[model samples]
Structure formats: structure tokens, C-alpha cells
Target chain A: MVCIMKFDNEKCGYCGACTSVCPNSSLELTENKLIIETDKCDDCKRCSIVCPLGAFLEVEGN
Target chain B: MKYDVIVVGGRIGGSVSSLFASKNDLDVLMIEKQPEIGVPLQCAEATSEETFQTIGIKPSNRYICSEIHGAELHSPDGNHFRMYPHNDEIGYILDRKVFDKSIAIQSAKAGTDIMVKTTVKDLIIREGKVKGVIAKHLGRTMEIEADLVIAADGVGSNVARMAGIDTLFGTKDIGSCVQYKMVGMDVDPNLMQIYFGNEIAPGGYVWIFPNEDGVTNVGVGIRNHKKTAYHYLNKFLSNFEATPVEMNIGGVPLSGTVDKTYTDGLLVVGDAAGHVDPLTGGGIHLTVICAKIAGEVAAEAIKGEDISAEFLKRYEERWNDKVGNVIKKSLKYRKVLDKLNDKELNALAKFMKGRDLDSITSASLLGLVKESPSLVRHLKDII
Candidate 1:
């Protein structure tokens, strides 16, 4: 099972804080927003802490 | 036993006051309650770059984090307002711990003695004039004597209270905030995001500020009516996979200046002065601005040996003139924002869509007010 990733685009500051901490490279900042590459996310939870806006969240459990 | 000026609290406002007082060749003593100068931080640490210019204080590499060009405001109903950079008016979110300590260091360098872990218990008044303070330090009680006392203490200031000033802040006038400092995340290092809504932060907003390295400062502060600043952050983060590195909880005053910030032989600055931005809960800039004024006034009062209420009134007048109008205006704006519901917020967002906004030239936030004219109906009451 894969947890669905949610991104509040408005809360994303495009700081790239999520991408750099994501061990799976699932998070990427593109054009001032955090985009989740669904296949790359391992539900590591790294993206959430580094995300300053609380913009990203996990909707489901794997 | 005697000093020209004594500043209570070692936060931004207190530090600023101490720095200026010492620089002017006055004898100064700065006291911090905590063992460390800036521990258990209480502020969001965001300030406008324009403020730094007025004080001629450059951002040191230690605490200076990311420089933000503009801000994005998000409504709970999937609405957003983004402001872009145009003028030289960029804002910066700082490393608050470092920023605060630097103020103390600067003050010390200017010849002020900073005492840490010194808790002030009460004010020492003589002849109906504020004289000094009684404090406890290192398992011993001591009295610090000074000609004038300046409360650089936080919102619930003991110094102000001890001076017979009403330090009680109504629930409607305060903002409760909770934040996290995460180290493993990455961000643009330039842009900031703010979220608003009943579910997220009622009468207040959530924010994400990115700094240098990989640290990101994320948090929320709702008006006094709302009590879920922490829960909202958790709920909002539930959708994302992340681990907390550090958690911070605090409050910001959003109701404009306190009714009374000064009295005979005593003055208040920083959070104690209630100089925060009523619209957004940002106070560092305003507090420091007022601190500069407070320090100057305190020094002058001490030199003239006239710490009367009328003499100290100068600080209030000077600070009010500098940012009083803007803060007062923002407080009125806050009233409209607090009463807004989801549907109303969406309509306001729709009204602001596609409007060219320059940070300086345009009233970026007022666009929402135009959409909801009901906000204007109470303008007479608010302003």
C-alpha cells in the first residue's frame, strides 16, 4: 500500500527544504511549489518536517 | 547599586534598548531571566529589511537566514494570494536565538552589563517614582538600583505590572502560536507561505519561513478566540511525511499597542509595549524600532533627572509617530479578518485575483477588504 501524498500548493514556499531532506527524492520544488513524484516517495516523513508551511501531508498508510 | 538605566528582559526590544543606552555612553544593566540569553524562544523572528536600514544594523552572518521577496496567503477553501518582489523592501526570517544574543553582545560591547538568569521579582518604587528592581540571581536575592527602569520583558511583563500599569491583555488582543524548527527539509530560501481559515487558524494565520542551510521555521498563530495552533499544524502536517526536529510554542500580540506602555520613571518596549503588527503578529521590526526610541528616551530622562510620566511620554510619542498610524490601521484590518467566514474569504480571494500588487505601492491586503465591504461597515468602530 502506498500513502497518498498531499501538497497544499499555497502553503509551499518553494524553499526546497522538502526535496533536500527527502531520502527518496519524492519531493521536488518546481516553480515555487512542492511537487511529489509519486513513484519516488517512500513515506520517509522527511519532507514534512523540512516543509516550513506544513504544506505536505500523508493521506494514507502503506 | 546605581546605574543610569536598567533594562529588564533580554529579547529583541530589551537588547535594542540596552545597546542604544550603552552606546550613548550611559551606564546600563540588562537582565535576562533564563540561564541563557535566548533560550526557549518566544517570537517568530521575521522582520522587514527596511527596519534594519533605519537602525543602520546590518544582518550578521550568524543569525541572518533567508531573504524573502514576497508572501503568499492561502485560504482554507483553496484560495490563494501571492505577492511578488518589486521594490527593495525584501523581508528576512532570522535565526532568532542568534539574533537575540547578538543584541546583548552589541549592548555589552557598548558598555552594558548583561546579567543572565537574573529574575526580577518586583519594582522598587520610592516617593511615587520608579526607582529600581528587586531580583533573584544565583540562589541569592539582590537589589539593582537605577535611575530608570525599562521593561523589555515580553507580553506578560512583570516589570510593567510591578510599576502599577495594567499589564492584563484581553484574550481578544493576544495571539497564541506554535512552531517547529526542522533541519532536514529544503525550500526555496526566498519565498514564504501563509495560510488562513477557520480550520487552520481562526482570526490568525499559519506560516512557513525558510532559512539558510536546511532549517525551515514553520508555525501558526490564531487570534485569542482560537485554541488550535498546535493541533492545526499537526493536522496540516498529517498529510505529509515528516519528523519533528524541534518544537516551539509562543504567543504574539495582534491588537495593536497596549493601552499604556509608560509611566513615571518606567517605560516598556518590545512585546511588553504591545508594538507588534496587529494584522500579522509580526513584532520584531516594530519592537526594535520602538526600542531605539525607548532607549534614547530612557537615557535622556536619566540625564535630565526627570523620570516623570510627562518626560517618559516622549518615548510613546516618538514610537507612535514612527509606526503608530500603520499599526492602528492594521488593528482595524484585523477586526474584518476575524469576522470573515469561509464563503466570505473565498469571495474576497476571487475579487483579488489577477490584480497587480507592488509591495510598497499597493495595499496588497486591502484587496480582500474591498471584496468584503461589510469589513468597512465597522471601520468607524475599529479605527
Candidate 2:
């Protein structure tokens, strides 16, 4: 299964809100970007729920 | 470069710790990952007058956008009450871009060195002790050594985690927040408005704090929910006629203070340490208090020539002695609050809407909880 979490950089405020709520600790916020550890994420959509900007979305994985 | 103390993240916690540490005669160096000292604001910027008093500076109008008089709280069913000040000053809405930088300036003026755009990529540990940091700036990586390290690195808290501390926040214990700095918002410029309901914010609340005339900071914070904070924020905004000037977003640790804020040669403060009120999700004041303690404790540890975990534990002890119980009590209260549904909240608000805000106490609040057996069970755990 592929990582189902999709990120839209344009909508990201880079505020680290998604990083704080990532239950799996799979999200990282570097100074310039928010990085996702897709393999570690369970596709829980916690990021989608907490993201204020809808930057994270769910997609069917190949 | 070597220093007596290295403070990571140059916001309130880092700057305050550096300020006090430098004043105590420590060679302090503060490193911020941002190119600017304060940019891309994440906070709602409402803080008390005590915050300024703690830092020994007058609250300047340059940074203070509006002086608040009191707060107005609204329940889902439209029942509301006002929280008036009992001889104490209310608070101020700050221009955080200016406010955060001013504090960093104060810390620098006190003889602390600062490097902006420098990120602490890793920590240098020797014999189970943190000795320094591996930092990156402009694609250049360098190692800076220090005797003691204070991690005020906000919610991401990579520095503290690198030093073997678990700064990760649970979904339930953290709040996902999104705020918009808005204009043409017709809110009372002197009152902070707070709305609560499960559908509105789930475990958190929404705020419409007036910044200046015709401008407001409208935001929403929700916890352990499937809906995004932005969705709720937009839903709330539909009730008002306002235009967004900028949108700010971040995570808040409402899990009470983190366990073990101190470990060999390293001390954690601010959001990284979970120095925020569990009930209100307010952190600036608590961060100010704990950061100062972290700084003073760091100075003492350096002077005592003991940078070990045992010595650094004093940082934890001192801060806990100051505001630890508040966080603990707030956590308990938050637990009880989280158990309350919209119906219970509406019922509680109905009973208190016309009562004197100053007359309400925990005992009286407990009496109100008696109306709902579900919350009473949780309330007993706190009482």
C-alpha cells in the first residue's frame, strides 16, 4: 500500500499545527517546510482534521 | 562557538530565558530557526499585564494594539456571561510581530548573543549528557558548544527530542488551531469574546479578540475531532462581516506540563515543556513564568558547576513550585470539561448567565455540575 496522505504546499501556512497532532510522529516541520513520513503514517486523517488550511487530503493509494 | 548557555528558538520562552540568564552574568547565545526574530506569527497575542510586569518592561503601545477590559463567554444555546476583572487589569492584544521581537531585543540588550535563521538540527551528547548543538544556517552546518542548553523550540520541539526527552503531544492533549487577523470585524474592541460548544470547537474554544478599531483576531481551536480548525473558523466567520488580512496556524500543548522537563545538561521550557493552561489553552503567561525560572535555574546550575541531570532538575523543581499546581488543577478541570456535552454546557450557562461572575467559585461550579451526573463523576476526580 502506498502512503495515502497528500499535501498541498500552496495551502500550508507552515505553522506546524499538523506536526503537533501527528499521533504517529510522522510529520516533521523544518524551518522552510512540513515533511511527512508517509510510511509511518496510518492514514488516520488526524492531520486533515487538525490542519486549519486543509493542506492535508486523503487519496486512494496504489 | 562556546557559551555558558545555548537557548534554542528566539520567541518568548527562549528570549525570556536568555534575558534572565544573561542578566545573571551568563554568556548566553540564542539561536532562532527563522530568518527574522519574529515572523509568521502563530499566537492569538492576547496576554495579561502581569506578563509585562514579569519581564520588567512597560507594555508599550507600539506593540499593544488594544487594551482589553474584560471577557464575554457564550454557550452553544446562546446563554452567555461576562467575566469582569476584580481589581486586576484585564490584558492587551499584542502585535506579535512587534511584541515577540521587542522581547528578543530586550534579551539581546542584556548581553545575550543571537543568531537568526540558525536551526539546531541535532544535539551533541557525551556520556549521556547534552554538550552542544549541530546547527544549520544557509545550508551551512556547524557545531556550537555550550555548558547548558535550554530548549524553547515551540511545539515541533526537535531539540528537546534530540536530547532524549519525549516532547511529542498526544492527539487528545494537543489543540489544533487556526487564526485569521481580520479587518472590518465589528466586535467590541475592549472585550475578548469566547464561544464554546462541541460542534463549534469540540474540546477547544473559538475566540474573537479585538486588536484595534475595526480589526479583530478571529480564531478557532479544536481537539480530538475530525473537522479541521479552519472549517470551524470559517463556519464561525459566516456570522460576522470581516475580511482576512492574514491567517496564522499552530499547535498548542494542552496536556498539562510534560513529565521530566529536565535531563542531563538540558532543560525544556515553553510549549516544548507543555507550559500552557490545559483548560483555556493559554500559554504565553505560563511560558513567561516557566522560562524565567528555567533561565534563573540555568544560571544557578552553571555557577554550581553541575550541568548534570540532577543539577538541571532544579529547573523543573523551581518552575513547578511556582505554577505547577495551576497546570495540574487546570488539567483536572479540563478533563471534567471535556466530558461535558453541549446540553450540559447550555444548562450550566443558563444557570450562571445573570449571576455575578465574581461570586462563582469552584464549589459553586461543582454545585452546577450536580445537575448533570455524567460530569459530576468526572468532577469528583478533581474535587
Candidate 3:
């Protein structure tokens, strides 16, 4: 089982805390957009843990 | 593969350590987890000209964004205190990516091998001694051996933890920070501003550092706050009409140094060792200072074939001799600042209204505490 990642555009302050903590380099903020490459994400939920804005949400799926 | 020194994390600390070691004719390897050396900049990027002079590096214009001579401090009640340097440039805003990469390039030229996109899984320890590391690079897990391993990895240092060092900092000791690179704002490009208040930043302060291109890094850092740093930053941004070009956030360990920075065959430097300023959250200068010591000591130890904890203690002793007292004093000041209410902050600002910048040293801070006898208790740690 894998976790589906959801990002709230309005809520994210784009601080890149999530990107910095993601062990797999699965998340990135480019041009003010938060990009999450699902294949590289290993369901660690580290992004959600470190995000100050709590913009990342992990849902069980796939 | 083997090397005389393996420096983890390719940022300023790791790169400088590698450079100094290689300059001493030691085989040094630097490994960075990121694909690129300095992408996703995580700093407010402000440092003094003295920092470069201390590191013995001539200032490069390639990455200097702005030169500053003064700063403005704002209290919660709209009181402001202005400070100016007596005779020289006091601060600078940096293009961190360019600055960091420039140092890395210099290290490479000094004969250091650098590997990017390599993630260190764990330390290779045999019989209570750190032997090397196991890392994954380009889909291959490889074991790299080194006589000495220098952990310059930032605050979330895996190397220190894997070595069984207690790197945990209390929540009150961590500063949560969020910053935005903004443009099209009406701000004095020459003055860095710091705002203080409970409503603005609970246990920390807000800063607006302007660059030469009219872009500004506006940010907030708070300690022991219930809300997230971005929440406060978003609220602060609501007051501005500027457009944000980029956003960066990270946690700074404001606690003093870790319990121990050196073990047999292993040394921790930079944020990994919690060398950041407790009051200002600045680490670049301290990182470079400590990394330089680490490099020199590691090179000498390897040369003498004595990479033992007792010998490595010199790195810690030299760094503490240079900056330990300042850090301790700052931590005492931070504790005093933490307990101050908005009214008292305004009062302190009022007292500082006419003070000259050069006169406001740590000793002067003690004098300020004397003015407010209530604050005298906090000086026990400082005095």
C-alpha cells in the first residue's frame, strides 16, 4: 500500500520545509508551485511532519 | 573506497572542511544528499564583512547581493531604534546559492572529491568506533571508508545520531523560521529591520533584509510558539503589497552547543553540532570557524596517525575559546527577552532610542538590565 499526497495550494506558504525534510526528494517547490512526484515518495510522511503550514496531507491509497 | 577524511553535507561547513584538508594534502571526499550543491537556499543570508575576513577569503562580488551599514529595531508599540556602524560595512545580504557553490568550486580545485545526490544511510561502526559510512548513490549502495568522518550535515544530522550522540534539542530551544523573497516593495535598501512583539513573533523576531536589486527577504523566527512559523509569516505578509518570488523555511537549534562534538574518529561541525547563535539564529560564521578548526585538526591527526577522541578535543577547545562565551551570553539574553511583555519591550526600545551602535555591546546589555532592576535576575547566567 502507498500513501496519496495532497497539497493545499491556498494554504501552503511555500516555505520549502517539506522539500527539505523529504528523504526521497519527492517534493519540490518551483515557481511558487508545490510539486510532489508520487513514485519517489515512500509514504514516510516526513513532508507532513515538517511542514509548518500543515499543507501536506497523506491519504492511504494505491 | 577510502579517503583520509569524509565530510558529510556539501554546504559551507562541509566544503570548507574539505578544502582545508585537501589543501593540507589529505585525500578528502565530500558527499551531498542534494542533486545540486546549493539549491533551495535555507538561510536569511545576512552576515558581516568580518566573517569573510576571519575565514581568510576575499569577498567575491559574484554572490554579494547588498552591503549594509546600519539596522533598525522596531518594538511592538511602534517605537524604533536605529543603529549605524562606526566606520565600516556592518552587514551584507547574500545570494546563498552563488556563494555556496563558489566555495564548493574552490574546494574541488583544492583537490577534494565531491559527490552529489548521494544519501548516507548509516555510519559504519565497528566495536564502538566509527569506521566509515554506507551510502546510496545512483541506485547503488556502496561502503566508503575514511580515517576521520566529519558530520557537517545541518540540524537534522543523521550522522551524529547514528554515532549515538544525543542531538535532540528541546522545543523551546528550536527556532521555527519562515521567509519570503519579495519584490516591488517600498523599503529602505540600506537598513535591515527587526520587529519584536508577542503578536508579531511570539518568542522570536521578524526581519526585512533588502538586496541591491530591490528584492527583500522578509521573514519571521519564533521559539516556543504554539502556532507554526508559516502561519505567523502568512499573517505578516498580509500587511505588505509586495509579490513573493520565493519562500524558504527551516528550524534553527537555538539551544547552546551539543553535549559533545567529538568522539573517536568522528567530529560534528556546523548546525549539526548546534553552533548557531542562540539569540540571532546566525550560524554561517560559527560554522566556518568550527569547520576550519575541524579540518586543521583532522589533517594533523591523520598525518600523525592518531585519530582519537583525545586528539580531536582540540577542535572543540579552540572553537569554544573563540565564541563560547558569546553564545552563553546570548542564551542568557534570549531568556531575558523571552519573559518580556510588550510593554517592557517598548520601554527597552525607548531606552535604546538614542544609543550609538558601537556602544551596544554585551557589557552595555548588562547596564540596561541595571536600569530595569526587575531584569537583574536574568543576569545570573550572563554575569
Candidate 4:
């Protein structure tokens, strides 16, 4: 059970802000697409906080 | 066991060396420390098509991510310049792991024995000339003799140093880098973004290479003297809206090549030789090219039964004649680049904004010095 970050496409601007902040490399951009690797995700929440559009949501209590 | 040539570190350079040696009917053995040939890939894998053609390698779809039409340069102040293909030539970003393994496979087909999970602990030196390597596999250390040994062991090559080749590189000579592979990245499918400024990556730049698989490999590299690369890239990227899915960290030795890449019975190629371009920090093209040179030279030496420093100097001479000037010139540009502040970089961006200038090739960047001739006059010696 690990905490995870999810992206909200509606609020996402596709600016690549969150992907760049992550140190653990849990997040990736695919064809202008953003997908998170759950196993690699440390759930640092840097992505959620850095999203200017407020598109990132944290799933707690994995 | 004895081989005609024993190659250490089976990446592009090592494999290329083995391939050439084997193709020339020399007994070659390639030893790789990694369990898999190209696993846990360490490179960005982008190289010019000219490299592929020269190496006689053709990618089989698994290796190519995007056929780069050109590169887009963005300044800190948001000014931009697009450098289209000068000769309608497209470069490519590859699946490096696959590409490396493919080369090793090809070398095997050409008759080079491939050994993975095998580490070369030290060089077997006698009478001040390299003869072979002391390697370990399956918890057993063994000696493999060879007429010549090719060292392609990447940036921090222990083999190079053990073989009595000096491996000292200046702090300014290295580029530290970090990258993120983000999925669902909504980037312009065609263009690769190169961001330059002191605030972004002093003495270096940030790059966003979009892969065709709906992912973007976002990375930043900076000189060692500047702030930590991760710090700046993380800070600057906080302003964007995309989320990171994966992260990668690596280093590129971006200075000109070492004074000598070859010695008695020894040759160092690729990053081990500091063969990266100073201006663009691109090493793939040179790595493959230098590997080809090392391969050809080692083969010729084996065929002629001459492996002296004088004989092996052929490889050194050949590279200098073809790509040496470009490397020497780029180091000069790197010196000029290190002197620029944020304001100067911003002004540089503003200066070239929307002018439809030529490509950002090595020559074009140096050409900028012509407009401001006095700015880099002190660097004329290296330029």
C-alpha cells in the first residue's frame, strides 16, 4: 500500500511542471502524456504541489 | 585465455571495437559488467543520422523514438529561435539499451565472444605496456591475454587509469545532468525544446525530448561549478503544469577530448576519452565515430602485428583530422559560455529573436562571435 498522485486532465495545462520537480522519477511524460509508475512512486507529492493548474490529487492511505 | 583483442565495457564503443576486430578476422572478446548488455540504460541516446550511416548501423524501429526535424532554442526571457535541418537531415533519439545490445549482438554475429556480468578488476601490465585484463566472473578471477586492449568503460574508467593513461578531467570539463521521463506529457509532437540561461542551467541547458510513445524525456544539464543540476531544474520546472512520472540522473563529459586517447597497446574511446562536443554536449555521434576509429585502428594494428604507441597513433590522427577541429572549437565556445550571466543570456536570446537565423550548429554558435567579435577575442587561441 503506497500513496499515489493522480493527474486531473481537466485542470492540467500540459506544461510539464510536475514531472520536472519529481526527484524519485516516479512520473513520466508520454507523447505529451503524463503517467505515474506506482511502484517507483514515492508519493512525495512534489508533483501535486507544483502543478500550477492545481491538477494533481494525492491518494492517501494506500 | 588469450584473444587477439580484449575489449572492456561492451557499450557502443566496446562493441564497435569488437565488431571491427572480428570483421577483420581477429579473435575478439567483449566483457561487460552489467548482467544484461544494455540494461539500466545511462544515456539520453540521441545521435545524428550521420553517425548511424558512418557506423554502418541501421535501426530496426525499436531503437528510434523520434526523427528530430530540428531543435528549438528558448531563452530565459521566453525569446525563441528555431533551427531547421540544414541539409534536411534528421537526428534521432533512440532506445539506448536496445541499441547497445543490438550492436553487441551484431558484434557476436561478426564473431566476437560476448560476456555479461563480467567485470575487469584491473589491467595486466608488464614492462609498462598493456597486455590484457584481470577480470572476474562467477566469483572467479581470471586473466585474458590479448595483443591489444580497448577501453570503452564510460566516464569514470578505472581501466583507463590502470593502464597508465591519465584520467584527470577539470571540474569545468564535466556536465552533470538529471532527467524525468513523464507520461501523458502534452508537448508539441515534432519539436525538441532546448532551454538555456543561467537561471536554468548555467554553462549548460535544459532539454525536453518528446518520444513518440506519448512520453517526454525532460532533462537538464549544467556545468559542475554552477549550482547542482537537480536544484535548478527542479526549481525552474516548478512553474510548469505537467506531472513527472519517472526520473533519470546521469553525467556527460562535455569538454574536448583528452590530450591522448591511445598509448602502447591501449586505446580509450567514447566518454572515457572525453570525446563529447563542448558546445552541444552531444557525445553519441562522437562515441560511435571514435569507436569506429578505435576498432579500425586496433584491427589494423593486429593485422600488422604492430601495437606500439607510434602505430596506435593512427587512430588519434584520424579522429583529429575529421572531428578534432570541431571539438577544439567547441571548447572555446564553452569558455565563452561560462562567462555569460543571466542578463547576457537573456540579451543573447533577445538578439536572435524571430530573425530566422541559421541552425544552432557548432559553426553557427561560433558565428555569433563574429557579430560581437570583440566579446570573444580573448578566446581566439582556442577558437
Candidate 5:
């Protein structure tokens, strides 16, 4: 089992604070969307903790 | 290649560290993940002249975009006060990209090997001692050994965590920031402006800094707010008839220094160590100052053949001695300011209306609380 981070486009402000605070460099914000490289993510939940808009969600996966 | 020191992140802090280490005749290597240094600048680019003097670097025309003479602070109720430096120039608005590159160039000139487009994957820790780094350069993974590793990697520091140091910053401790380089603006070229109002920026403030090229950097920062900094920045920009040339967004760790900045063979400098001021959110000056100390100490450790945490404690001790009290006071002040409502903020501003910048010290704040006993509740910790 593994955990993944998800970005909510509707709620995300795209300020890139989540990306800057992500310890693994797992997140990037483009012009229209927030991209998460699942392979690079260690599921530390830092992005979720730091997102001011509560845009990041944690999901368990196989 | 093995090096006496490995400096990560290649920004002002990393570059300064590399420069100082290499100048002391140590084998230093600086690594940056960016293809080019300082692209997509993340700062409002306002710094004081004293910063350059303290860093022992002369002001260069290549990056000095504007020289500001003074600043104006606008309170929540629209009451404003201006403060000027006793000297001619108060600060400078920088072309951050050029300024950052200049630091990198100086590092190279000081005999430091620089590698760009390189990403540090993890630390090569042996038996709980950091020995080197696992990095990817040009799509190739490699292990680079070093006597000491300096993590100057901004707010989100992978190196610090990889070295078993806690680098977590709570939402309240971090300031979410967004800014735009706007042209065609009608702003005072020599006067920077700061606006403080909960309606404008809930837990933070808005700043308008002008450049010599007729452009202005307009931005806002807030902590743990429902509305993001982008929301506030957009609202602020709407009032100006200006076109945005560039947009920058990032987080600033405003919690002062981390609990620990050094371990065996490792030192965390700059924003990675949370050296930014809690109230103002400025890190460049602190970064340079701390990085210089880190460099000097790392070089001495290498020469002494002692890269233990015991030896590295000098770096922390020296930096704490230099700015620890100031950061402590600023954090206390921020706590007091955060608890005030708009009415209280306005009243405090009114009380401080005729005071100059120097009078904004802790003593004046305590004096204000004395005059208005109602403020005692909020300012008790600060006083």
C-alpha cells in the first residue's frame, strides 16, 4: 500500500507555496494546473499541511 | 570529484558560502537544480545598502535597479507615515536574476566548481554521519563526497530532512507570498510603500517597491489565510494602471531560525534554516550573513580535520550571537500584532502617527501600552 497526494484545481490558488514547501520536490504548478509526480512523492503530508487553501488531499493507494 | 565542501542550491546563500570556502583555498563545489541561476525570481528584491557592505560586496550597476531613499507605511485606517534614512540611500531594488548570477560568477571566480541542472537526490549518510550527496546531473546519477555539506536550499530544504533534521514549518510560521513586476506604473521611484490592513492582507501586508526601469514590484504575503496571496495581490494590482511583466510566487519561513542548524558534517543556511524575519519576511541579508559564517566555519573545520557536530556548533553559535536577539524581538512583535483587530490597529497607528522609524522600537511600543492600558493585554508578552 502507498499514499498519494492530490491537488484540487478548484480550490488551489496556484501560488506555488505547496511546491516550495514540498520536501521531495514532488509538486509543480503550471499555468492552469498543479502537477504531482507520484514517483517522487514520499507522502510526508507537508504539502497538505502547508496549503493555505486546503487544496491538497491525501489518498491511500495500492 | 571529492570536495572539501559541497554547497547546495547556488542562490545567494549557497553562492556566498561556496565563494568564501573556495577563497580560503578549500576545494568547494556548488550545485544548482535550475538550468540557470535566479530565473523565475522569488523575491520582492528590496534590500538595504548595509546588506552589501556587510557582505563585503560593492554595489554593481549590473543588478542595482533602483536606489530608494525612504519608505511609507500605511495603516488599516488609511493613515500613513513616511520614514527616511539619515543617509542618502535607504535601500535598493534589485534585478534579482542578475544579482543572483553575479554571486554565482563571483563564486566561480573564487575557484569553486559550479554544476547547474543538478538535483541532489539524498544524502550519503554513513553510520549517522553525513559523508556526501547522491545527485543526478545530465540524467546521470552520481555520488559526490565532501568533507562538509552546506544546505542553502531555500525554504523547502531536502538536504536538511535527508540529514535527519526537522525542517517542518507550520502554516502559521510560513508566509505565502505572490508578486508581479509591473510596468507603466505611477509610483514614487525612490519611496517604497507598505500597506497593512486585514481586509487587504489578513495576516501579512502588501508592498509596492519601484525600480529604476519605470516598473514596480507589487506584492502581498499572508499566513494561513483562506484567501491566498494571489487573491490579495490581484486586488491590489487592480487599482493600478499597470501591465504585469512577470509573476512570482513562493513561501517564506517567518518563524526565525530552526531549532538546530547543524549536525555532523552538515550545516543549513538561509531560508532552509528559517533565517527570515518573522515580521518583515526578509531573508537575503540574513542569508548572506549566516552563509558567510557557515563558509568560514566549514573551511576551518576542514583545515582542522574535524567535521563533527561539535565543531559545526560554532556556525550556529556565531549566527545566533549576531541576529538571535533581533529575530526573537521581531517574533514577539509579530505575535502581538497578529492579535490586534482593525480598530486596535488603527488606534495604535494613530498613537504612532508622528513617530519616526527609530521610534518604532520596543520601548516606544511599551510606552504606547502604558498610555493606553487597554493595549496591555495584547502587548504584555512583547513588553
Candidate 6:
């Protein structure tokens, strides 16, 4: 299975909160952009929990 | 490009670091990732007179949006109280859009070169010592060398981690925050207001800081919740007749400073180093003070010709001497708040009403213990 998290770029505020709380070190946020390290993610919902705009969503990945 | 210092993330911490480093006659460069300094501000913009004094700058009328004389506290059960951090001292609600640029301008005037629209992709590390940074601006990359690198990159703190320091904050230590710059808020013009409840703010509180005239900053900071802070903030705004013109989202480190803020040729300050009041999540004063020390210590180390970690440790020592006790005490208070239930909060709020917040003593805790054993037991841990 691949990374099960999907980010809604259109809805994201790009605040970088998700990057700080990611226990697996799987998120990166630069200026006006957020990059998710999918390979390192462990399906942790921390990003979804803290995202101010509800931009992160869980999905079944192949 | 080479310089004596490269200050990353040009907010208050970066600008202050570059400003002081330049003032000490060191060639300094400050790099800000944002296209403009202070656009899309993440702070509630509240700070005290002590901040300006420590930076040795006069508070300009251009950035001072409102002067706060005191604060009002609210409990879940409708109990309320008023207090101030210091007696007979004024605070400020700033237009940070202007204040941040003003500090960057000051840094520039002090001979520190500034680069906007620049991002540090990685640090230059050799033999486990930070030598410089590989930065990119608008798709063009360059290796800029420096004797010292100060990481002031706010909460993410990616730069410090590149130097092999553990700056990753767990969810428990982070406060997910959202704020709106609102107009038509009907609140006391001179007093900032705080509302508390687990159901209301979950792990944090809601603040309605009145700006000059009718503008106010209404916000909420929540921790470790499934629902977002924006949801709680919107719920809180329903009671007030306000219109939001702008929104800001961010996180705060409330678990106090990281175990280490310095490494070989690298220093961390501001929110990156967790130089924030853990209880209040206010880093404005602490960041200014700590970043200034970082700059001075960097300059001192360079002048002494020892940029090693052993010599740079003085930054941590000096800052800890100045504000360590304050953060320690605030951490204890935050722990006490963490253990309280809504009933205990209401009881404590009622007991402390009309009493000076700073004057909570053993006698007061004893009086409170008589009412709620659980509440005072946790509060006693702080003593």
C-alpha cells in the first residue's frame, strides 16, 4: 500500500502546523506550499487533526 | 556569498538577530522566505512595553494599533476577573504588518543585508559543524557561506533540525491556532479578554483582543483535538457582531524550550527554540530577548575566533539566566491548568475574582483547597 493521506491544496491555508506535529517527520511546508513525504508517513492522523482548514484526508492507497 | 552570520527566517527573531549582529560590526545577512516581510502574519500581535525596551527601540505610533492597560479573564461558568502582567505598565496590540518590516528595516540600516523571497533548503554541514546554507530564491539556488547560522524560523524549525538538533514538537506540545482580524467587535477598548473551557477551546483558550476603534483580533488556540482550531474559533465568534477581514493560521510550542538550542556553529532562537511562555504561548518578548542574546553571543564568539559549540553555549547560558525562571514558572502553571476540569476552573475563577492574579499565595490555595481538593492539589504542585 502507498501513503493513505491526501492533501486538499485548494483548501489548505499553508500555515505549517502539520509539519511541526508530524511524529514521523513526514511533512514539509515552505512558502505558499506544503510537501508531504508520503513514503515516511505512518497513516498518522496528527496532520488531519491539527490542520486548520481540514485539508488532510485519509484514503485507501494502492 | 559569505558573511559573519546568516540569520534565517526574518520575522522578529531574524531581524533582531541580524540587527544586533550588524550593530556589533559583524557582516550579517537575513533571509526571509516570504515575498514580503510580515505578510500573512501568524501572531495575535500583542506584546508589552518591555519588548521595545529590551530591543532599545521606541514604540512608534505607526505600528501601535492599541494600548492595553489590563486583561479580563472569563471562566466557563461565567466567572470573570481582571489583571495585568505588571502593575501600571502599558501593553500594545501592534499592526505587525508594519512592525515586522520596521524591524527588518532597522536591521538593514544596521548594515545587515536582507534577502526576501529566499528559502534555505539545507545547511552546509561538514564534520558535523554548520558552515553555511544552500538557499534558493525563485528556483535559483546558491550556496551562501557564513561563520555562524542562527535559526529563527518560527515553529517548524526545519533549519535547526538540518543541523541534527531535535526541534520536532509532538502534538501534545503544539497549539493549533486560528485568528481573524475583525471589525465591529464590541469589547472594552483597553482590556484584552480571555475565555476558557475544555468544550470551548479544548486544550487552549479563546482571546478577543480589542484593537483601536472597533477592530479586534478574535482567535482560539486548541491542542490535540480532532476538530480544528478554526472550528472552535468560528464557534466563539458567533456571539459577537463582527466581520472578519482577514484570517491567520499557525501553531505554538507550549512545552517550553527544547533540551538544546545550540549546536556547532548553529544557534536557535524564537519559536524555533521554544522561547515562548508555555502557559500563555506569548513569544514576542522572549523571542526579542533571546534572539538579541544569540546575535551578541554569535558576535562575541566570532570576535574571540572560536565558533565552536563550546564557545556558542554562552548564548543559552545568558538567555537561561535572564528568562529561564520565567519559563519554568509558566510551565508549572500550565501543568496546573492542564489538570483542572471545568468545575475546578469555575471554582478557582470564583475564588480568585477581585484578587490580584499575581498575588495567588499559599493562603489562597488553602482557601481554594477547602472548596476543591483536586484543583488545589494540582495547583500545589507548582509551589
Q: Which regions of candidate 3 fall more than 4 Å away from where they truly are?
A: A1-51, A55-62, B85-89, B357-383
Model 4: runs farther than 4 Å from truth?
A: A1-62, B356-383
Tens-digit lDDT track of model 5 for B134-195: 98877799999998999987776778878988776777788988888889878789899998
What CAPRI class is candidate 4? incorrect
**Model 6 lDDT at residue B308:** 91
TM-score of 1: 0.80
lDDT tens string, model 1, B15-128? 889888887778999988777777766666788876677566887778888888877777778888777756758788888888888878888989999888887877889998
lDDT of 2 at B277: 89
Residue-wise C-alpha lDDT for candidate 2, range A1-62, written one tens digit per residue? 66577899888888876776666778878777887887888887767766777888777787
Chain A only, candidate 1, TM-score: 0.73
Candidate with the greatest DockQ versus the true structure: 6
Structural similarity to truth (TM-score) of each candidate: 0.80, 0.93, 0.85, 0.80, 0.88, 0.96
Question: How do the candidates rank by TM-score, highest first?
Answer: 6, 2, 5, 3, 1, 4
Per-candidate Cα RMSD to the true structure, in Å, reads: 13.4, 2.4, 5.5, 10.7, 4.0, 1.7
Candidate 6: residue A44 lDDT (0-100): 77
Lowest lDDT 10-mer window, candidate 6 chain B?
Answer: B374-383
Candidate 6 residue lDDT tens string, B1-383:
89999999999999999999999999999999999998888998999998999999999999998999888989998889988666688989999889989999999999999999999999999888898999999899999999999999988689998898888888878888999989998889889999999988988899988877688999999888888898899888887777998899888989999989999999999999999999988889999999999989999988998889999988999999999999999988987898888999999889879888678777887888889888877776665
How far residue B196's Cα lies from its native spot in candidate 4, in Å, is 1.1
What does candidate 3's lDDT look like per residue over A7-62, in tens digits? 77877765444553556656645324676787897776655655566676767777
Clashing pairs in 3: none
Best by lDDT: 6
